[model samples]
Target: MTASNHPIVGILLLAAGKGTRFTAAGGEGNKLLALYPNSNGDQVPLLAFSLSQAVASGLPVRLVTRPDEMEIIAMAEQFGAAVTLVASSGSGETIAAGVCDSANWAGWLIAPADMGWLRSDDYVQVAAALSSDEAQARMMFDDMPGHPVGFGKGYGAALSQLTGDHGARQLLDDTKLVKLAGHSGVVKDADLPAQ
Candidate 1:
């Protein structure tokens, strides 16, 4: 799991969204800070759960969030993830900044902060694929393409050039992407307060 084995592969957790939907769903706080109980009866904030998984995967991880989310930044740092506070403009801007900051990295495994259910194994698989010489990019999904896409070094410049709200989907369309077997959690995003 060292960068030498997977040179460009780094975990970038995108958490800069405004979470307007969650707010509309009666979430009075940052969606990333919303609490959810685990089976062990430990109450954890939604974002913390995701960050734990990323850290457990043994990859260098960077969390991108808004300036106001110092709580999330501190939490990520506590878990040993490198953190970057990007403007809460859109996914594209946040992602672009992350890619730039990790420019030395050979690839990126991008995940949304809301996908608290993403399995650690799924992340391992994507990173494994990115480590291979043939994989330019890899995507996971249940029945369709979903979040937590892995991009190789070949797409670095393109990813850094991204702007606005558009995500890496366009990069997937333009590159040779390898798809991992579907996992329903791949498409599940915490869009509402109850989710």
Candidate 2:
């Protein structure tokens, strides 16, 4: 589809996961709720920071979160994102929920909520690349794959069928993925309090 003729490419922010690993690794409470210092000298919640960046990208955003996450739901709504609630705390479930919630979009840029360090420009750059390319694309940092993975409209069904905790790893391996050089923050995640 032509760039102008194509449907809107929205951002799917996955925030439903339990972040059990982070807590198991000694992190306190939910990792998404943990405060992280931003460049503005303010400590912001990880998920809130990530959602802000997604909103700043100038694209429609859909946030998948748990029903109990009132703070996250409020932050997402404040950012004007369409929120979808899921009972299971799984990446695949979150992805499916977000995709199903915004199924009318032309495509989606799936991003993990833990990657709070990614800037708005990063999302814009990846969206631009995905819009121009015929195949799916993903951010690559120092030869490693990164998040905000872009998928064309053709893969909507496959993305929606996702389940369990693997997210879209299988789709990435099965599709024609174009790798773009994303900033270092693409590879960064709030896995620990010190990070």
Candidate 3:
């Protein structure tokens, strides 16, 4: 059976937090709105790049964003993604909203908005890891933990309780993680402009 036959593993995109660092670093409004080149050389919004990758991975997606982010929310909905407007700008709050919206999914793949370089293959691999007997899967590159972390059903309550800048750190640390090692792109976050 293919992945479509299995229970859906949600890809929750965290887009609510204000990108203070990114904004201070010269990025316009939401860091997500900035245009960046994609693997195909197309200039797309930063969040669009990541959302496109998640959509290509063949997984369900839920987006947690601020109420003011109508543009981003509209774009994500265009891809058939569920949108949850969050009141707080904290990473944890954003995640919990996404998680609650995706409560029906078999597992959860938590990804941030700024890590736009990740591709469909990365999302696919992480989903595969969470589909198995393992309770959780954390995407790792060069031995460093990164986004798109997968959480098994056991993490629902704890994940729902998350509410600060710390998204899923505590929940992930408490679970037995099946590290999905991959190319360095797994860790390529758009935190700073490429030189």
| Candidate 1 residue-wise lDDT, 1-195, digit = tens | 854654557899999999999998888789888888876988789888898888888878999998878899899899999988878578888899899999888688998988888877777788877855335445556457775798878788888888888877677744567778857877877888864
State TM-scores per candidate.
0.90, 0.91, 0.90
Q: Residue 62 CA error for candidate 2 (Å)?
A: 0.9
What are the lDDT figures for the candidates, one per model?
0.81, 0.83, 0.80
lDDT of 3 at 126: 78
Ranking by TM-score: 2, 1, 3
RMSD of 2: 2.8
Model 1 weakest lDDT span, ten residues long: 133-142
The candidate that wins on lDDT is 2
**TM-score for predicted model 3 compared with the true structure:** 0.90
How much RMSD separates candidate 3 from the native structure?
Answer: 2.5
Clashes of 3: 0
Residue 67 error for model 1, in Å?
1.6
Taking the candidates one at a time, how many backbone clashes does each contain?
3, 0, 0
User: Which segments of model 3 are wrong by more than 4 Å?
Assistant: 1-6, 131-134, 193-195
Residue-by-residue lDDT tens digits, candidate 2, 1-195: 864555788899888888877988899987888987777978888887898889998888888889998988998888898999998657888898888888888788988888987888877777776654245888889999998798888788998989998988888743468788988889988776755
